[model samples]
Target: MPRAILHLLPLLMLACALPAQARTMSAKIARVTTPVATLEGVEVRLDWPADAATGELRLRAARVDAPDLGYRFRALEWRCPLARDGQGGWRCDGELHADGGKPFRLSIALATGSTDAALSQGKASLALHRSAATPDDTILDLTRVPFAWAQALSAQAWSDGRLTAGTLDGRLAVRTPEQRPLRVDGTLVLADGGLETPDGSIAAAQLGGRFHIDYRKPAGSTLLSLDGELRGGQFLYGTTYVVLPGRPLPFALDAIGRDGQGWMLPSIQWRDGAALQAQGSVAFAPDASLQDVDIDLRSHDLSALGARYLSGWLGIAGLPDLEASGALDARVRLAGGGLSSVDARLHDVAIDAPGKGLAFTGLDGDLRLSGGAPVDSELRWRSGALQGITFGAATLPWRSADGTLRARAPVSVSMLGGQVRFDDLVVQPPAGGNGLRIGFGLALQGLQLGELSQTLGGPAFRGTLDGSIPAARYADDRLDFDGGLSMQVFDGSVDVTALSMERPFGVAPTLSADFALHGLDLMAITEVFDFGSISGRLDGRIDGLRLVDWSPETFDAELHTEPRRGVRQRISQRAVQNISSVGDASFVGSLQARLIGLFDDFGYARIGISCRLSNQVCVMGGLRNPDGNRAGGGFTIVEGAGIPRLDVVGFNRNVDWPTLVERLAAVGSGDVKPVFE
Candidate 1:
């Protein structure tokens, strides 16, 4: 139409040849630089040919991909239904994919402006909004997805872990690009899941109820607070074992402390089982290693729990049903899977087992445990007594008194090859008829044969011991041994002899035995002299046999003698003279005639004697006397007169009474030698 319009037509045509424009700029330029490479802007204007100012310009490509445009730009694809906005920047609301990028696929509401922002993907979605001049305040809300999906995301994002929150709401601050902003403050629940670290696993199923946590950004470390009940809960690490119930445990427990490499369990109350309650503290290492533990317990019954927990220490399995009730205060420390120290005190308790297993009243004691040093203790049992004391395999039985019994020091006594230490001990006997009452102080290295024999009956024995035992009493089917005794004997062995008791083995009346001697010297015997001029070895055995009320009835004895060297033994003159009269010896009529001249005395050329000693007289048989009277049968005769006198002795008729007396008297006085020594 006009000449000027015609000239501008080419320029307008050139501009129209390019993409439509909603607003035109005086000059548009794009250039590539070192850091940024390039920047460009575009404007869009659409007209509807059908009617009006509404129109559309669509740009489409099957796929648009860019691996990297620079250090920050990544491979991306964008799809949007473009729409115009009042601002001068482009607007697109659609899905965006950033393949091979730091943060992958994401969705956003896009409106071109001078605002800066970022988004992240995690178990929960996070958004950060910031301006060019200010810091970003973030919002990180837990994902509403199912637990499985959340766990999967957690696994992929963290180290083979599963984490999900029931409800969470918190604020975050993104001060750095490396760590994600973390915000948590809500009632979080974990179920059928677990959190694992280098140390071990903390399973979700083991923890129950609602828990609240307050978390901070940058680190994601949390401040945890809990007030809930757990059932069938168990916490274990190596040698440490702990359990709690979803319902109220037998006792109450409280733990209020900080979390670190080590964990703490503060207080616990146990309701049943073993009839005990305790309050204590426990700790463990980072790798689930055991540390120290301390506790105080009160027991309603101790003896009844023999099978459940006490059998190991006592070396006895089941015991007679018993009821024990008492208060015990105890403290125990453990380290490296072992006990470090333990202290316990018991007060006002009684243990009762059926059939008088053991009866204790008003028993008080202090016990120490662990370490290379000895465990020291002191105990007092008042009004205490023992009935039916048995060696378990022995026939001896006894019962004891009601009095104060005490252990003074660290003294050990062995039974069945097991030892129990006692400090100082004392017991008193019950009243009865002449019952044994004893006060003893002795230390024997071992059992004494003599002492044991005296207690049992006969047959002496010897052994060794090393302790002091007090005397005791026995009376009327009961015996009480007080104090402690120790001794050593018999080639480094210990012997206990002469253990005296009122009534041994609960026998009637009473019994007391003293072991006379054992291991006697056989060679050194026979030192005491004087027995019919006989010098020889003498061995003697004497037994203090049975005593009914304390007197001997039955006895055993034996004696043996052997001749000793260089010892003179003489026979009595009376014996020689009597034998001569009995034998066929005589100095009668011829001997009597010779005596008148020079022979006043008598002598025998050969003297022989033979006489039976049953009856108390000597009878001669054979040659007649000067009176010509013969004696009886089985008679003996003697003859002697002056020197070299012809003497003959004989027996004839049964010797009458007055006949042999006169002949023997003269012979005896003259022939027999005097006895001095």
Candidate 2:
């Protein structure tokens, strides 16, 4: 044989020795347990020489599951040809898939004699391609697999999980086409239960919730939309309670967020039974601080809100015994660490609670919080009334300073055709090493005493109260009012030296006043108490008159009395008889006694008395007509009815205050009822 023929024979032998088959090895494996290989018959015809080339080879699989390799690939198939490039390098081309076992997902092309592929699962996936010439390292690409199940996913605890007919029919999709970022879209049901993140365990029970969440990959940040109805469910997120359906509830929400804009809930609505409906929108900045909010709420009964939303805040599981109903609409905005303003309207407010002794009817009002700008805001109220009493319009203004709030407007309330105004309401809370200072003034004008008395648990008093208290200081919750008042009807001028009130505007304001009454008609004053009158000019001065709890404490007083000229003092026969019996004065002058009796009260009377304040004693100048009778001697004293001398000396130390109040009140009403004590 020739030498060339020998070489050709070797090549033919080599070609015949190779397997001869031709067909596409398109295969797929998913969730496979053990390793398996499949090879179809292939056609191969080759004439091998010193530097011969290998034809192209392609590997295709919908998804290859290689547990041993910790890899599960979807649409992973490749094409590689055993050929030398002009630069003597190798490459390949094919396609790759994530985890789904579908068709050719990615396209790949290669010019290499060898190819290696693997798909992994559990937490991560890696793809590698290596060559003999470039054997120093392998081309490695890694990807993280995100949990896409809509059941339960939380960083804290195992979420409540459920796959009911409602949830199962609901489609949920979570995709992370890029590393370290994920996007979610789906719909859930109220019957789908809730996801609970307790201390450690993430579990799920009968879920009654609807939620959508989009988060970054590897799970750090998120924007969520949650809404649903729950009848009776418990979700414990570090003592956080979410309202559930079952008893009657409906809720919905829409939320969105951007990387720098932060997480925000743009819309929210809730309804509980037939009780309340609340709708609001909230926005937040990147730091999770409040940006703006608008809330509108309507309730059939505010007292019934306990079973719905307010129970948690009141620290009571049940509602108060007060029955109230109203509808409210409000809009609030905040930015740069301060509240911008709010606009609200209330309609059909009615309160009726008998046991609580509260009654009100037909109340409606419009309230504006802050205006549009962030500088100064005014709150105005219109068409407002409290408990059937109509009131004039009012406004309150607050200005912002260095991220804090300071009131800049006076507060006013009008009722019964009168107005009460408050001014200088400044609250400068301590900020940056500066102590906060507060100052304000109050004025009451033309307030009808009859209506006020009725509201204040009195029968009625026909009069008016007009006064002004200007400027006060508050530090550490202690308030000092420094002002005075003057009135004509009280027939005197009262000087308010100094008074301090703790928690004023909440409880009653404590009062300390000094009063001096000049020569005023005592008979006219007696008409106020309905006591039988004695015509005379009376004068007195009360010093250190302090009241606490609306009850007088230090009552130091002095009194002077004298008969008025030309007025026959009608000392009653009863007064003549009572005075004759109580005081040890004998009727030495029957003629003068008759004169006093004829006057129906008293005549030529001069009495000096000192009340030892806390001891409740009137140390009187012996009961007799002064100048006409001598003290400690036989004196002519009128009898029967002056003011009743109850021998109440030292009564303060022994008086049962509550019983005294009852008796005194009865006496003012002209009832001679015995004291309850």
Candidate 3:
């Protein structure tokens, strides 16, 4: 109902008191102004007939503007029969239409001390009451009203949010005191509420809640405080996705807004029984980016944490299916959208990544890190495993400050019948223009390779592994070791240099290194690999070796028996046959084929084989000629030294890497047959 009609009711009442007769009255005003709205081109008409107890009223307004509320309406018209009530009050009911929009029933009741008005469309309605004694206040009663009706008010605060769907049923009180800020207080019941921001970074759906809200705007600033119980909902903020439970969860927030500087949330609280409890303060920039935040969180039941609260972050961290169980309390602080500090206490926690061969159990710690002043902390875990290698209990002491975290002392963990020591460790977390980086020194002492081989499903190798990496660093998802690792196995030493890995925790982890084997007893190596027995001192080098997903992708390798004063160079008949089969080679000998089988073993002056692998292909080579070059026509795999000697030669120079691997595997399994030529 237009206020113009209400103001003219008194004149109508006075006219009704006259003698019964056919009469008409009209009034035209160029403009009318009120505290809340301005009307232009207002017209009012009244018609009375002697036979009628009521008068016909018509009111029209060319335009109505309420700039403060962001509401503007054009071409508003209403017609109704005006009548007097028994108590000297007035009532009118009519269809109100505005700007070619839907027509709703507009009913207004005016009494000596109070006024009531209602606008209804379909099943939705908004009713208002104002008492003359309290002119500054208005009470609104909503019934199944579309949430969109509040868009004008919402725009005053959240200019970027669009209410897409939902309905409200609640009561609200609006107060506008003279020379004071406007205030609104309400208790609202929301159902299926949905809202979204333009950038798709913040959105909510199926949000259902009952909330009490206090909102005020004073000149240039806005303030809002709300406390509510959310029944269920799903919301996304940047990479954080939150899914409210079906059971009610208590939530509260208080915030202040500046005209062009966005919002400053002074308080936020949430409680989910036995699962999570959190309190935080956050500030956002004009562009809605997080500027500062401080939060404290506790979880008594971590089993539910991953799916309910951690999925979005874990997915982005490349551990989407990570699992955990235990109790934890943590506080985190951020400044300028980067981490400032973190303090966490864990109790009997267990974390696991299925199918990744990484897990930890019985973790207990109070870990603290700071970006400003120094902070010290310690973490201890009972057991952990990486790539199937289990390690025993260990404690790590740390100090953090100035955006860097460093180990306070060397830490050692029992692993594979020995210990792995880490020293001089320093870590820098991801910050401006940089990713996470870690530097450490690693030393392996008296580790048993036999146990390692068993866990890795490799050959039953027997040795004590000892190695030192004086310097190692990890950054940009890659780990590089400046020094080398050495293992004492097969009565010899194997040194690995230029060791590095990429995507260590991500898809298809890759590793590259160079290996040098010296003075390894062939008999021990053959027995371990289940290759045919041989007696010699073997030396080899594998350079540019690369593996992807733990499978060799490329390498340049050469293995040979080097003569020594006290070492006898002999190849068993089975060894010769297996070598020939694996190399796709043939035996050339003076002895007949039938007679060659008679000898159990043969002497070899020199034996060598080489393969340069690339692009899934292996380019094969063998012992060099006397001129220090590859032999032409064919390559000698084994050069004979004694009478009735056997020489092995390979004709093919290229082989599919996978096929060669299969051949080697067949020899190890005793599934290969020799062809003598």
- The Cα error of candidate 3 at residue 168, in Å, is 3.7
**Judged by TM-score relative to the true structure, which candidate is superior, 2 or 3?**
3
Each candidate's number of clashing pairs is 78, 65, 0
lDDT of 2 at 495: 40
What do the candidate models score in CA lDDT, each in turn?
Answer: 0.36, 0.46, 0.84
Best by TM-score: 3
- For candidate 1, give the lDDT of residue 351: 61
1-677 per-residue lDDT for model 1 (tens digits): 00111111112222334333443222232322211122222122233244322223322122222111101222333333433345532333334344443332232322332322223345433333333344223233333222443343233223334443332223333232323533333444434333444444443335343344433332312222333333444443322234444454333444332334444556544554444566676665544445667777656556444433343323211232445666566776665445565676777766655433455566667655543344445544444323422112111111222322233333343332223233333433322223223332433343444544444453343443356445544344444455433333332322233344443332232433322223322122111111112222333333433344554433333333323355222222233333435333333455444442343233332222222111323232322233323333332233332444533345543343334445444443454332211
Which regions of candidate 1 fall more than 4 Å away from where they truly are? Answer: 1-183, 190-206, 216-224, 248-284, 290-408, 411-677
Report RMSD for candidate 1: 29.8
Ten residues in sequence with the least summed lDDT for candidate 2:
1-10
Task: Report the Cα lDDT for residue 268, model 1.
Answer: 49
Candidate 3, residue 630: CA error in Å? 8.9
Please provide TM-scores, in order, for all candidate models, with all chains considered together: 0.30, 0.49, 0.83
What lDDT score is found at residue 107 in candidate 2?
18
Candidate 3 lDDT for residue 312: 84
Candidate 3's residue-wise lDDT over 236-353, tens digit each? 9878888888888999999999999899999999999878999999999988888899999999999889888888877755577789999999998999887899999999999997
